[model samples]
Target: MAVPAPRTVRTVAAALSAALAATLLATATATATAPARAERQHRRPPHTWTVTEAAHAPGARIALDDTTGALSLAVSRDGRTVIEPSPLGILAQQADLSQGLRFLHRKDRAVDERYRAKSGKRLDRRVRMNETRLSFATAAGARLDLVVRAAADGIAYRYVLPAGYGDVLGETSAFNLPSDAGAWLSTYRVDNEGRFNQYTAATAPTGEYSDQALFATDGGYTLLAESDLTGTYSGARLAHTQGTGTYRVELADSRVHTDGSLTTPWRAMITGDLATVTGSTFTDDLAPASKVADTSWIRPGTALWTWLAGGRTAGQSLGAQEAYVDYAAAHHWPYEAVDSGWYFKKDEWDVTDPDWRTDSWMPQLVDYARAKGVGIIVWIHQRDLDTPEERAEWLPTLERWGVKGVKIDFMNSEAQSMFQWYDTVLAQTAAHHLMVDFHGATLPKGIQRTWPQVMSMEAVGAEEKRTNTAAHLTTLPFTRNVIGSMDFTPGGFQRVGLRPNSDAAEAGLTVAYESGLQMFAGTPESYDQRPLARDFLDQEPAAWDDTRLLAGSPGQEAVLARRSGERWFLGGVYAGAAHTATVPLAVGRGRWLVQTIRDGADGLAQDSQVLHGGDDLRIDVVADGGFAGIACPWHPGVTTCYR
Candidate 1:
């Protein structure tokens, strides 16, 4: 073989020698010097070469620089500066895959459009996608890639590491924002035990992690979020960077195991009008395709939760749960959730205890509920799901005993270990064809697209906390529920909101919130006391075919319209003062029966009218109250045209 030229050999030798000397120097100073250690730990190796690969969509473009591995995204239709070329890289134990990496070849492809989630807050998201991959060789000779995608919704990027084992040290790249942009950051815990905190980007506290960070610009909004997280990765947080409005990604835990090759969760930056941003369905689009062979068993419906009624029961025991099941049966609910303390081992909630609590109560209740056509879902603590044996042993037993699902609770952290464990819970439960609902858990990130059996996650600071306000209820559709299913337990019709005269927010919540399994949290007997309230609960569903935002903003009034099958449900909520607005309908041709219920002098007022498609119906919501009801055409097929 022919040898390389002298100049080329000299260049290679110089690079290798420099890299070797720097490594040696870093190791030499690792012993005693703190500054030296910090420098070695934080310093990024410099890159000497550069090239850019870019792809454009209808209104957006994403460009990746091979030189510094920075990704710059632009939403150009509005002529606004979305992101001004942000550095994108990773830090790992074995290699600083950040900067100072040699560029390799790249490949580009486009994802063909397809439709899923037929309708919800959107008609159907046509998956228009353009993807590019830039390969690199780190200074330590490790291989990695920056995979970028430009879609109709926004731009997404992820790091692709070769099959290996090590801790993912951190991020080398950050999202730099314009100085004028304001942020809407949230500190609401997915767990039921926390308070809600919302603030702007610049004033956001350092070191705290927010599930969703929204930056509002003059032209539109910019969203920084993550999705499709699996067992290989931990939950990620958007942290405030030192710069005026810069933010960076921080993994709850960076230690990762790439079964062979690993693809990090998508680092997404979505931009557009409130409607565009709110209606975009990229969270589901970016997730892995479903792995289940038979998803027919997966069902979505309303259920009754027993835990929140502890205040009513005062004493927790088997009789209280049976009473809830009786109401579920009477109301025609599809399921009932038997909350924690159903077993002897209250601390660890995995399975049956032969000696202490394997009483006939659970079996009798399960059989009774099943006989009544209502399924049973039991609540279990997360601690019991610590191992494969634990999962393997209990889930099958529950399945054999006719338990339909499990509300897995107490996942207090979003660390990498929790991510793996969460995956195990879903997979194990799915293997037995059982559904799941997560409580005391991290905000769910698009995993439901892969596992629809995961009905809902309790991530919103909702009614269950008893601190929910009209503002909180109104803000959810635009923030928390906009990204994923929110288990905002409703139906305590007697009271509502965090302020006075708030009783009217209940019906609005039942109609506004989106979840696969809607579990009403108050005593079932309390609901049965009022026929109108019980009737509304019986007529409602958990998930919908289509959803549309009608009015308001965060912490303000909200009017939303949803479609299930062919029927339409609309609801609105407001606080501080009385509200009235003319609502536009997107329903197609022909007239329909519009039955509505709003706040009344004493309880609730109900009215009915014939409404034609494209009608602008004006509604008056009194102070501290809301509205909710249905609109269905007398003639179904002819009136159900696309809007």
Candidate 2:
């Protein structure tokens, strides 16, 4: 015989059928008992049911109150409390689903899923978790389901509403933190390009707007973010009260009307050690599966972009674009981005030039690029291709001209309509066999999983603006880049206005930052000036088979080692004073050839050495400096590990 689940209520139909029979039997038995004993039963408290596996793990755990219909969650690591009991529920237009409700039924199961990523931090992923679905009915007789998943890394939960629920006003989900926890958070921006500042839990900012918030508890670290967003719901932000260690969810729109069934995105709490914080795939794992049937045409690689070097002046002509294409072909980079000013006017959104004489340059350049084994990614303002009609008008023409990708710019919003537009554009791009890179866009939320052709998105304060500091750069790996691909446009040697990083850090960003379409941000002449740095850029890979956080932390230093094949690449960035960083070579057990580039007195320095696995490679770095290296399997008398 099978064992019954503990703390589970009977289904509504079964309970209703048994109620009259049980009441009659109880009436007959009460005649033989004392009336005082029966009256005392009304004073008992509501039942609190726990959700955990057969052998309870020491990670995140969940619970629900049967009578009150309130849900709360907590997290622990190595027997220390990381997250306290936090409130979670929904507020529907029909009824207040948070209180005055009754339990209906409960279901629990195990989930073990495996899939291959087209482009991301890791190529192969396994998402294993224990799931619980708890059903409840509100006072107004409205039904809702609270779904929770407990993974090895952390926990995630979301709301599922049936049809006829007119509107969802908001969510009552909040992250309650400890009093001593330290936090790193970014103020809300439409483009999600804000600096992350550190604060204590009590002193954290109080506002209606915020991006992802990271916290360091006594036990470990935790990051609060959301994923699997669609057009039905607007993106959310954190609502905080001053001096309180609690933050609640506030939607961008005041209310979202839903006529059909709806499933909100997963509210994820990724918690663990420093390595877990940096290496966790919890966010993307919560996304929906891929919608594209054929993904062979989607290739992830580096691109040469000229906008950072000289703005529109450098990429405005056919000769300048050809130079970029030549440089890309020389370095084995797969793509070259042709930015704005390719059309009739620099600022207008016109790509349909019927006049062949004025538009003849595009096809000529496309043919030249195709002959050189390079793909051209043309830039278009987001307004030009946001709708189905607009995309149907130009996408096929660009396809006919043999353009492989499109760089859509200036989205700058996370409203529900923009979310729908993102889906429409990505689906259309995939149908036409083209890749996409979003600029001036909101932070990535695992849309890449559903649409593998979304190569990258520029949601960070990239090099094109030149306002990012070393500390800001160091903070991204643990925060923004943790969720999905961030196109920061690394590898610029020369500095312009307000840029304060060294040449060594520029090289380091190329490896530390992970993006499917990594843009090399320098003119061809600049790379010619520093050939060794160019050599390192040529050796780096855009996507990884595996990744590890070897050393350092957020806002101090970040040392990462990522693997592509049998070889491993290491990148490190440091802030504040100059120092030597000790990085352990955890590649594997064998003799390996190592080529390194670091900070010198004048510019970037380079060296080559041979060492065994588990040996430390220490490099001296200057203030706000960085270092990068490649390690390959080595035998006796080997001159080069990579061509």
* TM-scores, all models, native as reference: 0.83, 0.90
Model 1 Cα shift for residue 228 (angstroms): 1.8
- Candidate 2: TM-score? 0.90
Query: Model 1 off-target regions past 4 Å?
Result: 1-77, 113-126, 138-141, 188-198, 241-243, 254-260, 310-316, 345-358, 494-501, 634-643
| Highest-scoring model, TM-score | 2
lDDT for model 1 = 0.69
Q: What digit string (tens of lDDT, one per residue) describes model 1 on residues 383-489? A: 87778887776787788888888988888877777787887777778889998888888775777777778888886676755565566666677666777777878
For candidate 1, which ten residues in a row score worst on lDDT? 49-58
lDDT scores in order: 0.69, 0.80
> For residue 332, what is the lDDT in candidate 1?
86
* Lowest-sum lDDT 10-residue window in model 2: 1-10
